[model samples]
Target: MSRSDEEDDDEDFQAESNAEEVSAAYKLFTHGAAGPITLGHLRRVAKELREDVPDEVLKDMIIEANGGVKGQEKDVGGVSLEDFESVMKRAGLSFG
Candidate 1:
């Protein structure tokens, strides 16, 4: 059994497609001019993309693309101690 000429073309096409995927992801994920910088930007992108995705899913994707933390990934039941400390510090109520 051997490969056909068309298989080689398909591989080349796939490689080009993969490169495009990376380019687009990098542009969007790195907060380029078109990325979400403020709540308004997020709202605008959400409005534009809502038809292709559910609200919750789109929100999560936007967060991930903006390099958001994955603090909620570990457990959905309760917050971690470190998370609580970070939140408190941000709120200017940290004990230490």
Candidate 2:
């Protein structure tokens, strides 16, 4: 196969792997729920895991996960799966 074809195959594999990672992380945060993950949900999960993460830090995470857009930090309602995936990618974080 050509170099370009190999590159495409690699990209496809990477995409599938990323999707799986995001799905797992999202499920962990949402407890298998079918809605966007909220700050409360994150806090509860952290507490359950005994992570001791501060609320401020969690808020910042929510904002960042929401793309850190201008004028939206204060109104971040929740973190959708897509937003979570984007933030995880941007931060180089993985569930693996």
Candidate 3:
């Protein structure tokens, strides 16, 4: 195959892998919930993982994921799967 074809194949593979990873992360964090993930969900997941992250830190995470807009942190509802994926990408975080 040509070099261009190889690059396309690699890109396709990476996309698929990223999708799978996002799905897995969503399930794990949301605990199979159908709705968006909230602060409660994150706290439960962190507790289950034996992590001792503080509530303020968790809130900060949500705020940061929601574009870090000043004075709007208190209005955050929850994070959808798409937003979660975007935040993870922007933060350079991955399930792998």
Candidate 4:
């Protein structure tokens, strides 16, 4: 309950919060987004988010996937939340 102890706890909390914020910043988009996410689909994605997606991050994932901004293409590996349930069913990751 000392002042130094409180200060240390505050520092730890701040560090954790900052780390979470930084991680969130790098997350360009999330799953269950209502449509496909390919390079060709960036415009739709922006619309779904109701804001402009980060140019750098969106461009990078699309380029990494070799997508051409098309709106209908989904990740074949089914890594997105939209397909995650099915994938978990196949992989048996589901607890239920």
TM-score of each: 0.31, 0.72, 0.77, 0.32
Tens digits of per-residue lDDT, candidate 4, 1-96, equal 999999888878876765454334324443334333444456555787797777666666554443333334453321233333333345443222
**Model 4's TM-score against the true structure:** 0.32
Compared with the true structure, all predictions reach lDDT values of: 0.46, 0.79, 0.76, 0.47
Model 2: lDDT to the true structure: 0.79
Which has the higher lDDT value, candidate number 2 or candidate number 3? Answer: 2
Expressed as tens digits, the lDDT of each residue in 1-96 for candidate 2 is 999999888888887887897898798888899647888898998999889999889878877777663244565577888888777777875433
TM-score of model 1 vs. true structure: 0.31
RMSD of each: 15.6, 4.1, 3.7, 11.5
At residue 2, give the lDDT of candidate 1.
45
**lDDT value for candidate 3?**
0.76
Candidate 4: C-alpha lDDT: 0.47
Identify the superior model by TM-score, candidate 1 or candidate 4.
4
Model 3: how large is the Cα RMSD against the reference?
A: 3.7
What TM-score does model 3 achieve against the real structure?
A: 0.77
lDDT of 1: 0.46
Residue pairs clashing in model 4 are 39-69, 40-68, 40-69, 40-70, 41-69, 41-70
- After superposing candidate 2 on the true structure, give the runs of residues whose Cα lies further than 4 Å from its correct spot: 67-76, 93-96
